[model samples]
Target: MLSDIRPAIVSTILFTVLLGLVYPLAITGVAKLAFPYQAEGSLVRDSAGHVVGSALLAQPFAKDEYLHPRPSAAGNGYDPTSSGGSNYGPLSADLAKRIKGDAAALRQSTGHVQIPDDAITTSASGLDPDISPQYALLQVDRIAKARGAAADEVRALIQRNIQSPLFGFIGQPRVNVLMTNRALDLALPKGQPKRA
Candidate 1:
């Protein structure tokens, strides 16, 4: 019995060290060495070299001058640590109410009677970093007017910033919210600083 227990304990310790510790460390090391930028969270920077945000999560922008991300089911909106969906069933009254409220808010803010569902709906992961291209275009007018820039210019900026789907088909095309906003800031008209 003593011999049996000793071998079992020793094997458990060895497996834990190898599988739990060594394997993870090795994988992490290789990832860092091969893809340092991605392994470090894909942080974005501003023209001033200040770290602004990550490409992985959305950031809220309630003002009219900036394009907005998809509605987040996270706390308040876009809370990274609280990443999750609203969990409302398709037939849930609560979901309907929320969508209606969001639509109304978008209409009021942008003065556009027709609101895209993507503008008001939260993605399943609650960390969506993109809006539908239609949704982004819809806000172009409002954002351009608010920023006192030509609509065409803003549209051009959006077009330039659009990211294609991974491997051409794995997922939908997306605009990384933080990267887009950073570009906006960098491309701001000579006199104006990009507003938050």
Candidate 2:
């Protein structure tokens, strides 16, 4: 019985060291070496060299001059600590009401253009920094008008920022709103504030 129990305990310790500590450390080392940028959270920087945000997480951009990301149900909107969907089911009256309010606000802000569904819906993570191309296009006019730039120029900026689908077919094309907006800020002349 003593011999049996000793071997069992020894094996348990060996497996724990192998699987619990060594495996995790090995994988982490490999990931850090192979994908340093992503392993470090994919942070984005502004022109001033200040870290602004992470590409993996979304932040609120309510001002009309910037393209808006998905509606966040996360705490205080885009709080990474609370990243999650609203959890309201498709048939939930609360969900319908929230969508209605969001749609109404969007229509009022963007002047009755055919709003994309993504424009009004919250993403599953509530921190998706990317929005559909259609949604990005929908906001171009508003952003251009607010920034005092020509619509064509703003459209071009959006076009430039449109990220292709993974391997050209896995997911739909999307625009990283933060990157596009930062590009807009760089493209426009200094001291210009968004009008509406």
Instruction: Estimate the TM-score of every prediction.
Output: 0.86, 0.87
Q: Would you list the C-alpha lDDT of every candidate in the order shown?
A: 0.81, 0.86
lDDT of 1 by residue, 1-196 (tens): 8779988999999999999999999989999999998998887776677777788878887777778899889876788788889989999999999998989888887778887778888898788888877788888888788778888988999889887888999888767666776666567552465433
lDDT of 1: 0.81
Top-lDDT candidate index: 2
lDDT of 1 at 80: 78
Q: How many clashing pairs in candidate 2?
A: 0
Q: Give the residue spans of candidate 2 off by over 4 A.
A: 1-4, 189-196
lDDT of 2 at 86: 90
Worst 10 residues of 1 by lDDT: 187-196
TM-score top scorer? 2
